[model samples]
Target: MKDLLLVLPRLARMIGSLLGDREVPLSAKVALGAVALYLASPIDLIPDFIPFVGYLDDLLLAAIVVDGLLNYVDRSLLLKYWPGGAASLDTAAAVARRLAGWVPSPIKARIFGGRRHTA
Candidate 1:
C-alpha cells in the first residue's frame, strides 16, 4: 500500500504527459478526464468516509481506466512518459488489469477508443 501510494505522483505525471500527447485517442482522453473528475468530485458511487470499502468504487474505476490505457495505448509511448522504471509501470498495469478483469474487453476497447493511432 505504501509503495502504491508512492507511485501515485508518478502515475499522475504519466497521465498528464499522455493527455498532452496528440497521439492519444480522443476517447482515451475523454475517459481519462472523466475518471479524473469523478475521482476528485464529492459525489461517488461509494462515499470515501467509510473505513475499508470507502474507496472501493474509486479503485475499481481507476483500475478500469488503467486497464483501458494498457490495452490500447502504445507500450513504448506509455514507457516514454512514465516517470519510473518500466518494471514499476508494468507491475502496476498488471495489477490494474487483474482488478479490472471482470470488465469485458469490448468495453475496455471502447474506453480507449480502439487505439486510434493503431501503433
Candidate 2:
C-alpha cells in the first residue's frame, strides 16, 4: 500500500513530461486522448452494471493503453521524466508489459511513439 502510494505522483509527473515532449510521436498523443475520452464518456466496452466484472473493460483497456504508451516510449526519455529510481520505473514498465503480454507486437507497434528520444 505504501509503495503504491509512492507511485501515483511520479507516474503523473512522468506522463505529463511525456505529453509535453515534442519528440513523442503523434500517435501516442492521439491514443492517450482517446483513452481519456473513453474513460470520461458513459460508454464502456463492458457496461459498468455487472458486480465485480463491470470494470474489467476499463482495466483491460488501461493496461493495453499503458503498454502501448510505455513500449515505444524511449527508455532514456522515461528515465529522464521519472522522479524515482530507475529500478522502480523498470519494474513498473515490466508490470505494464506483462499485463499486456497477450497483445501482438505488430499491433502494439502501431499504437505509440516510434522515434527514440535523444538525451
Top-TM-score candidate index:
1
lDDT of 2 by residue, 22-68 (tens): 87777777877787788788998788888768877775566677777
User: Which pairs clash inside model 1?
Assistant: none
lDDT of predicted model 2: 0.71
User: TM-score for every candidate vs. truth?
Assistant: 0.87, 0.79
lDDT of 1 by residue, 1-119 (tens): 77677777888899999999998777888999999999999998888999879999899889899878877788888898998889999878878888898788777777776554554
Compared to the true structure, candidate 1 yields what TM-score? 0.87
Q: Which 10-residue window of candidate 1 scores lowest in summed lDDT?
A: 110-119
Alpha carbon lDDT of residue 5, candidate 2?
54
What C-alpha lDDT do the candidate models reach, one value each? 0.84, 0.71
Backbone clashes, each candidate? 0, 0
